[model samples]
Target: MIKKYLSATLVGLSLLAASSSSSAKVIDFEDINFSPSGGFSGQDLTQRYGLNFTGGRYGFSTLTATSYSGWGAHSGNNYAWGDGYNMGIEISGNNITLNSFWVRGALMADDVGSITVRAFKGSKAVASKEFSYTETYHLETFNFAGIDRILITSRGSGPVLLDDIDVGFASPVPEPASYAMLLGGLGLLMLAARRRKSS
Candidate 1:
């Protein structure tokens, strides 16, 4: 009976670990404050989201019916815009897996173009892919794991728009409840062993 209970406890722990590891977080850009002049730049997302933009100027804008046609926000009323040719996003606190995101070219005369996304682990490039987008938003999947930084570059004129970024931490911090459960499981195992020894 104790052997069966031990096996079941091990299985439960395995399932818990698997579930926590596979958890992903989606950043929809809806919680950010809206800019009055249509868009704003130099905003830091590190404190709230553990992401920092560098290499090029980055901004956030609220999507409008008059300015953008055919395409709309992927999740909320706002999205991130990148100026210049290249932008680098550095992930702080922990390495993350870049699951997927929505991207498209801004709705302007010269905004149609191809964009390249590259994932890096420190200084080494791990994965890269190029995607062509018009005014319509395209869902791009990377599945790049254990990456610390992501580089996005425009192959043509005009800025790139991004929304609904999905990412998962390589090492997820356990909740207090999780810790208590782990401790309880270990205590039960110890108690079972002590009882068997006494018998």
Candidate 2:
């Protein structure tokens, strides 16, 4: 019975260590405090979202009864507008791994024609993609590791629609003492099993 309990404890400890190492999160742009009425823009979105930004203004489709799906604004304005003529989200000091975001052409504005999305580690570009939007919005997944910033440039037009930015960060690394404890527990379990076999 003691050996069984020891083995279970070791397994639980392993799982706990793994789960405490990294976290995945999503920013759906649904936390804005706007009433969702007529056209709204010219605000610091990075500040609004508690992030960092460098570029043109960010806005949203005026609040309306009939609009994008799954939005919590006055109406259903689910899209965050970026006069993405030239824009980028800089996540310095806050080391993160950008996962993905949804992008579409800004309605009635300028179709987001072609655009280039790039992920960078400092001044070095790690990943990039040049794609054009169709009639519907698409989720562009970025699989870069330890990226500090992301930039979006309009290849053709100047406006773009964006939503649901996903990012992840590695949790603090465990201290050496944690490893010692884990190994010590396992060693005891092994010793117990060996003694049982001898008996």
Residue 6 in model 2: lDDT: 74
Report lDDT (CA) for all predictions.
0.67, 0.60
Alpha-carbon TM-score of each model against the true structure: 0.69, 0.65
Off by over 4 Å in 2: 1-9, 36-38, 47-51, 57-76, 89-95, 181-199
Candidate 1 Cα misplacement greater than 4 A, ranges: 8-16, 35-47, 57-72, 86-93, 172-199
Clashing pairs in 2: 36-63, 37-63
Judged by whole-model lDDT over C-alpha atoms, candidate 1 comes out at: 0.67
TM-score of 2: 0.65
